[model samples]
Target: MITAYKKNDMTSFKIKVVGVGGAGGNIVQKIYLSGLGCETIILNTDSQAISRHRAHHLITIGKTVTRGGGAGADPDLGKKAAEESIHEILLKIQNADLLILVAGLGNGTGSGASPVIAKYAREKNILTVGVFTLPFEAEGKKDVAFKAIAEMEKYLNTMGIIDNNVISELVSMESSVKDAFDLVDRVVKNCVESIISIVQETSDVNVDFNDLKSLISRGGLGYFAKGIAEKPEDVDKAIESVVFNPLLTGVTISDVKGALINIKSNGELTMNHFREILDKIRAHLPEKAPIKYGLQKEGDHRVDSYAEIYLIGTTGKRTTDEVIDKITSKQTNWKNFEIPPGVRKHKK
Candidate 1:
């Protein structure tokens, strides 16, 4: 068994993505399928849920309460189940250098247990990044959902929030809710993979794990922006698509304190191309905040003209509005819920 705190306790330099509950577990399976060069684990109250999932590592918790059945949307029961299995979770994450948590809030296990797990990991001083999905307005339990997020943000290095309503709107008109969610999982995976590439893969310019560590550890609500552009004219649109992506609750370049820019492009990427891209991105960001950049060159030479760029940054402080608001619309019926404290925004 991999022991905990094997590396430097504050940072592991290893990456682990843990998914809590059914929706969270489902997303974990998607990221696992991508083979992103990180350890992936799934935790759930349902034995059948774990059995069907494809992650190499799986933990079924709360078998006593639910008897391998589901949480039945009872968040209180979900939280209790996670407490019962905290020991196993601690052991599983003992050696992690960086932990990325995935889940869909508003449900029982994701909303209840995920925050508990994040708290334990943070107590160990592990760098924790959260990638979470909120339910559609139609779900009606925004109270439980946002509470879980606020609790987790107290310990997260950065958190990426994806609005399921946005996902629902962007997906094919004929798609099922499951299909829409699966598509949203792909968005989550892409954003997380972009971050993973920075730490795990070598870059021509070099933005190592240490840089990422410094950025997240300094304390702030995390923000991530990503876009792909091929034509020279599409620069603004590409960058806008990323920074102003609808998935983010209401975050912008203005929300973060520092920034890291990374480019994954073909060999055709030229100095002129990079400089223009950099200039354009910087033109919109605050003049005072520092920007760290790196480049990854791909061998594909089939007349490629597109580059995928990831801009990762977050503020040392996030306002209450940023936490509870959405980029596209207002929550007409969610007003009864109080804004949870210590909230961070994460978008995929």
Candidate 2:
């Protein structure tokens, strides 16, 4: 079982899981088995699509819009189904503490419902995170996947959303379908674990839904980062020295004046070590920029020597102006880009 200390005395946290089709069904099943100890709810736009799969904790939502078909064949039906799914999900998760979205890329249900669900959840004060899979690059679904990703990113900028891409290089290395699914499951579980820890453990370093939302919305090209020792010998020591538990999500390099650092620990954190790391980062900071730092403790976890830094970059109007100038310089002639003849039209 997953063990975690509770910071609040609430009876139980409500977590809703919304899946799109077969891919989403698979992810929800794995999360159900992960045993995070929260009340679970599941929503699938296509009920018939996931009828073969069963979960005691899931609550399937909406009727099937299409049978024995792919998402690309019918855009209108896809949008309608997604709208119905979101409506069902909102009604079920009114008092939820968290909403976890799981689905595969290039689909109408997953892509369409995710943003709407997230918007409603945030308005209800629910912490939201999305674990979505991307389509394989050569599958001719790149445009579909890209549009979905861009939409999700825009929503996340304004709301709390943490995403894991299933089509990464590491995921591609898996030999079998089961192996790929397992790898993706592990990554999603780890991310969930970290979020749970932050919520349950009262630490000075706790990250709230708002903080996460702000970081992701502004941070461009976000990637995870973990701390590693400058040097290593044995594997165990290496693991201990390098803090694998630290998950730095999303990073942006724009208009960032400085950062406010907060540290939390059960034990004493060496001020010198903390300063050393900060100093190294500050060297790169713009001159005369303001930086704030603090330390506190309230969590159950002990911190002999641990620190996780989330680097965020900010951008301003100046950056946009510069980009426009750079792009215009290379444009000798301008023409409206259009789709080639006979390309598949978006289905109504």
Candidate 3:
């Protein structure tokens, strides 16, 4: 098992951002400028596409397409591009305490390569997290995006991933491409900041490999909530406080029946405390949902219960093996997910 460290004890973190032509490159550039203090590496297939936006730290991988840089016809080519890019990036990530991946899916490069990169990072025992963008419905790239999303969802169900709908939610908020880019830039910036905060602030709370695996496997954005309460009765109040606000409130897509609940504490995760927390959560969930709980003794912070509860959803029918097979079965053309023609001059 890989040894874990407290947040404060972590000395360095390395983040790699991969993109398929200009979109991925643009996002990586924004993240580099966000000033998170972590070592940053940018990986792309086309050197020419990212040449102007390249930073001293950015590293280009693979070859650019001489012709059309759009999504490829053959699926296998995408996987090949990703594998090669990841093989190169792995050398740079040797001792990184944390790995953050940024990319937009549906395109050949980012969609194809992300999973390979994620698998490699996990094998190295680095805590890997992905911040990915979904394609817009109107982009005529929906099928490509959907396939990529399905693959991503399948991979993420067993690994760490954070989904951001850039084209739909982020772009629609603004009128111009510049405005959309700025909005996405801000979102990516906030995400990087939050991650940095978690790494920098020392916490007695230890997130084990099992916990990380379980979290990335079964949890999604709606599964997370944060609040503090000292007593059993107060726990309900805490969850309620967050749920009352429409913006903070979220609903789970999965039934959550037969779901497992794991709780960790520096002290004891008492039966009484467990019941209190479980009951509070159940109050918001469906009455028939079956829940189970487990406890650990590592968290030791006083200002807060140092408590976090995660809910795992298992409604999807897709299996991990099927996803892997699909990814591996395809030929590695690597050229399909290239930058489109005439979209020159990468933007911030």
Candidate 4:
């Protein structure tokens, strides 16, 4: 059985997992089903879509404009929907200790509403972290998604990203439709789960909610990786595998500003094993950066001497204007940059 610790009571931290669009809603649904003990809500322009999903709450935005139909892949309308219903959204998010915004950018609701809601949460002094999936080239939404991401960087405390193209190459290929989506949802669920578990799961080392708050509130990109190590020596290897994990698609840890490393094993885990894991992980990173780490060992008889190590950290590089300008460079005479159509249908 898993042993959960308590220093700052879990009840004191009010966490709301808000699903922004169809994709976001779907991800949040999986997280809710995992029973992580957070309030889950789905926000969408599609009334029909939200009605079909299961969550603690369902919020339909831009009811007057979209008539409860959908955003029609228009980011402008998605933004307007959130704007029109800003009051209700804020009310729902009020007093939240942390907000995890889940969505797949490139759709009207996800692309448009994500940035707006993030900015609103920041205005209220609530820490916000965005978990998102980029559109595939087949979906013809990358260019649009890029613009939305640039805007979101301004308000989000940290962005945890997964590229759909990478997911296609690594996970969804060769699988049936339902199975493929199950794989996709698992990635999203794992990303959200890893972070929440860091805060909610108690340990002897205690990487509590406040520690996570300090790590995320720096306003840059967030990196989270978790995997198992079969042997004591495999602890470092587990962390290395996470660096190239598909969920983080395109990030490098060479220049991380701040980092938190966590490792867990069965009851036989030792402090020496934990220290070596931290040392090995740091050896791969920049020399000067100090690392914060924690350890936990659950007394499960079925498990032996194995370790599950997670690396959670962020680099402060929120230069929204420069990044967008570099992305949409005026210096180059590039082609129309339009993605091809005939991709899968939209979902949160």
TM-score of candidate 2 on Cα atoms, chains taken together = 0.56
Q: How many steric clashes between backbone atoms does each model show? A: 10, 7, 12, 7
| Better model by lDDT: candidate 1 vs candidate 4 | 4
Per-model TM values vs. the true structure: 0.82, 0.56, 0.54, 0.82
Tell me the tens digit of each residue's lDDT in model 4 across 1-348: 112234546445778899989999988988888787788989999999999888998999999888998998999999999999999999899889889999998889999999899899989998888888877779888888888988888888888777756545443234566666665666667667667766655566656777788878876667766666777667655656655454454444654567776666777667786666676677756776556666665634544658876777776676876444433331211121111133222323
After superposition on all C-alphas, the RMSD of every candidate to the true structure, in Å, is 8.5, 11.5, 11.4, 7.5
lDDT of 2 at 272: 62
- Residue ranges of candidate 4 with Cα displaced over 4 Å: 1-11, 229-237, 270-272, 297-306, 321-348
- Residue 160, candidate 4: Cα error in Å is 1.8
The TM-score between candidate 3 and the true structure equals: 0.54
Error of 2 at 331 (Å): 26
2 versus 4: better lDDT goes to? 4
lDDT of 1: 0.71
Candidate with maximal lDDT = 4
Model 3 C-alpha lDDT per residue in residues 1-348, reported as the tens digit of each score = 112333334433344434344556676676667554566666555556656675435555544431224334333455676565565677777676566666766666666666676667667876655555545545455466546655555334432222333223222332656654555544444444434433333344433334334434443332322334454455555444322211111223233333444444536446576567666666655666554444444455532464544334232234545433333332111111111233222344
- Model 4 C-alpha RMSD vs. true structure (Å) is 7.5
